[model samples]
Target chain A: MKTPVYISHPGLVTPLGLGVQQNFTEITNGNIAIQKHSRTDIAKEPFYAAMVSEAAINEAFKSHGAISEYTKLEKMMLLSALETLDNSEVKISDKTLLIVATTKGNIDVLDKDSAFNSERAYLPNLAKTLGDFLGVTATPVVISNACVSGILAVAVAKRLISSGGYDNALILSGDLVSRFTLSGFQSFQAISDLPCKPYSKYRNGITLGEAASSVFVSTIKPTQFAVQVLGDGSCNDANHISGPSRTGEGLFKSVQDAMKEAKIDAHEVDFISAHGTATIYNDEMEAIAFNRAALHGSLLHSLKGIFGHTLGASGLLETVIALEMMKQELILPSTGFDTLGVSKPLAIVETIKHQPINILLKTASGFGGCNTAVVFKKVS
Target chain B: MRNGALFAEIDAANFEGFLKQLYVMLDCKYPKFFKMDTLSKLAFMGAELLLSEISENSSEHKRTALVFSNRSSSLETDRKHQEAISSHGEQYPSPAVFVYTLPNIGVGEVAIRHKLQTENAFFVFETFEPEFLQKYTVSLLNENKCDQVLCGWVEVDGNERHGFFYVVGRNGKWKHSAATIKNFFEHD
Candidate 1:
């Protein structure tokens, strides 16, 4: 029999709050983080985004290490990883692996007026910095795949641990809403002016957000609420570098492959944590993919309405939230969703409901035509 | 180069010129080759050279995964995008350039060219970690994720261009191990 991997000890730092419980409580109480930000350093015009408070991050990080030595993204990532390490019994050792996931790390350093050296923008350098801070001896791995970097990191951790390469793996994923990303999204005209309404007919574009989340994957169960990493599949559409496939070919295959590996059918999944970025094409494509996978009966919700699109952190952040929902036996609603917009219909959750969630599926699709689907099962 | 032997050396001035000359020598007809950035061009060239002999059957393509790593993660295109949005330039960032800002786009470009819809991952390391790559690719194959994997280190930063790509399969003449991979990367 193959070794089973379990995931637990979620650590989150987002616009909503610091800890996983805090963010979960805030989302349960119907709170959102996206707001209008007129910061000239990030954008030329006011844009809506879910931004973590720098003041909060600085205050929280003050107790851990010297504040000036780390970049904002590093501070957020370090704090999240520290929480995971402290809350769990796992210890850092030569066999322990650290995976850092991000599309752009310390990207602010590239700005003309930045304080730090531009070399910090390199992904490997950022991973090394995090590894040193976390007391990880093994050479850290960095995944720079567009937005799917987060959960894909988790999948990588599971594979490494299962392959007997590591005792346990700590995966930290973070990305900032900086001038680089904001300007690029603006160039594509993909940024929304209002809080995003995913899967709604009136939805216009994505609302960018910033966050850092950490998850520990190991062969041993870390907590009672720990979930088993049943299976995962990542596929590239092989169509466009920037745009998602209209036929949802990659996502459809990903979900199908994941479920096949997990030895489960479409009817077995209780709920889905979808990558609903509130963009027209993305939502439509997801709807088609879900229908194609025969997942129309599963309750689906996109946390983007609450956290906005957290880029690299979205996949893992939403997966962490899904785990919490399974533990709490509650289904969170899709915050900004209204009428069904996509041509194919999806069972979008509209309100919080107490239900037994045994099997959960998390899916993410991002730039470079990449799509990832991971299946998780609640431990009883 | 095939089997560590020089197939043909192009006489050109710079990296771009060398790529153009190589493209002509290879007789590549794909128009998208001209639009890709330097990183994607290098990766594409390497993938084309390696996969040219493989059959064009879609099922075979479906069982092939693309595993790539690099030191500089799309720094060339990132510099261009940053310049456009900086105060020094017109502040009009082109979507085309911004799309290639991520290192995986090069992998995506190769996937699109070869129509690979299997597992894909792009890692960034300080230097090439052959042991890690060997283990990870083996695990993917052992786990039945894919039958064959195209794995390598493709690093392109301005004038510095280097790519080492090879195909790993269930049956091979040479063992797919860290020492062998390191030898191939170093000797080439």
Candidate 2:
């Protein structure tokens, strides 16, 4: 028999707030954190983004006096992981693995006029630093699989713990809103001028965001409300390098694979945490995929409107939010969604529907034509 | 049991030429390869080198998982993108260069080339972890997540590139064990 993996001790640091209670309250109240910023470092023109303020990070780190050696990205990840680990009984020893997921780590160190050595910008260095801070002796595993990195990390951790002798694994996902990332989105013309309207008729593009989220997947359940890691799958579109498949073939296959592994039918999925980046092609593609998969009846919402597209952190952050939403029995509205946008129809969660949400499916697709789907069951 | 194996290393001076030479040697005509960034190019070359002979009749191409890793994580392309912006101005960040900034683009490149739409992922470790790679692949294969795996480390630092790729399949010649993976990874 396969080992059961349960998710517990969720910790998140986003523009919405810190911890589950604060962010959940703010998001449930329909308070989105995205705002227009004219920072010269990011861009000369104003850009909309959900960014965690430096003051907030500094304030959060005030309790840790000996953190001068860590970079801003490392600090954010460490803080998020610490919060989650604090509530857990699992020891961070050789038996416990640390999986750090990010699209870019310490990327700012590569900018011109920066004093830090460029090697420090490597992802492994960032992972090692955070793992060391978490008191892990084993070498850390870093996942940099574009936007899917966050959710994929959880899947990897689940498999590792289930198949190996490890009893616990911590999966942390993070990315920063740096000048490099912002300008890259701008270059692609995929940056929305206003708050991102995911799955909306007027949706333009993604609003870049930054945050760090952590989840502890253990063989032993730690809480009554622990979420079960049902099954997961990842597939490549094999169609384009930067664009998603026009047919959503990768996404369709990913959902099919995940559902097959979860041993659940499409009708059993009570709700879905869609990627819903709000871009025209991406939303259309997802709608087609869901419809093709016969998931037309599943209530679905995207947290991108509230958190923006958190990139590497989006999958895990959205999963964490989905767990909280399930715990509170609140179907938070897909903020910024006004009218149906895609060609295929979807039961997009428009209002705060207070319905029982169990057996949730979270899906994410990224630039490299990568698509990932993970199934989670709410523990009663 | 394994059908074929090959390893290739490229230096900065002959990187482009080496790719072209290998492309002709393998008689490949994929035009999109020329557009890939250095990271993708190196990974694609490694995949081609290992799977050139054996992957021909494998109907389960879609079932082949790519377990790739690197330490640099696209720093070379990052530097180029940064150079493009700095050398040009603040208003000009090349989207083409910007797209390759992430390290997993290498996995995507290999997937697109080989039409591998399976359980693909790119990990960044401090160094190559042969045991971890072998264990992860074996677990996935045992779980029936994938039928075959193309796993290895493809690290590109500046002009120098080193790649070690292995095609592990069920009912193959080589055993998919940790020690065998370490041997193959460290061989040549």
Number of clashes found in candidate 2? 3
lDDT assessment of candidate 1: 0.90
Off by over 4 Å in 2: A113-115, B1-13, B55-57, B88-91
Tens-place lDDT digits, model 1, residues A1-380: 88999998889999988998999999888899899998988876788999999899999999889999999999999989988887586677788888999988888888988989989988899999999887888998999889999989888888888988788888999999988999999889998879999999999999999999998899887656769999999999998998899999899988998899899999999999999999999999999999999999999999999998988889999998998898889999999999988999899999999997999999999998999999999876
Residue range with the least summed lDDT across 10 consecutive positions in model 2 chain B: B1-10
Write the residue-wise lDDT of candidate 2 on B1-188 in tens digits.
Answer: 12333334434347677777777667778887888886788788878877776655566555789989988888888887777666647448889999999888888888888887778888988878877787788778877888888886888887557777777888777777888777766664
Residue-level lDDT tens digits of model 2 in A252-282? 9989989998999999999999999999999
Instruction: Show what share of the native A-B interface contacts model 2 retains.
Output: 0.72
Q: Interface RMSD (Å) of model 2?
A: 1.2
User: How do the residues B19-107 of candidate 1 rate in per-residue lDDT, one tens digit apiece?
Assistant: 88888888989999999998999889888888887887845456899999999998878988888889645468999999999999988
Per-candidate fnat, comma-separated: 0.72, 0.72
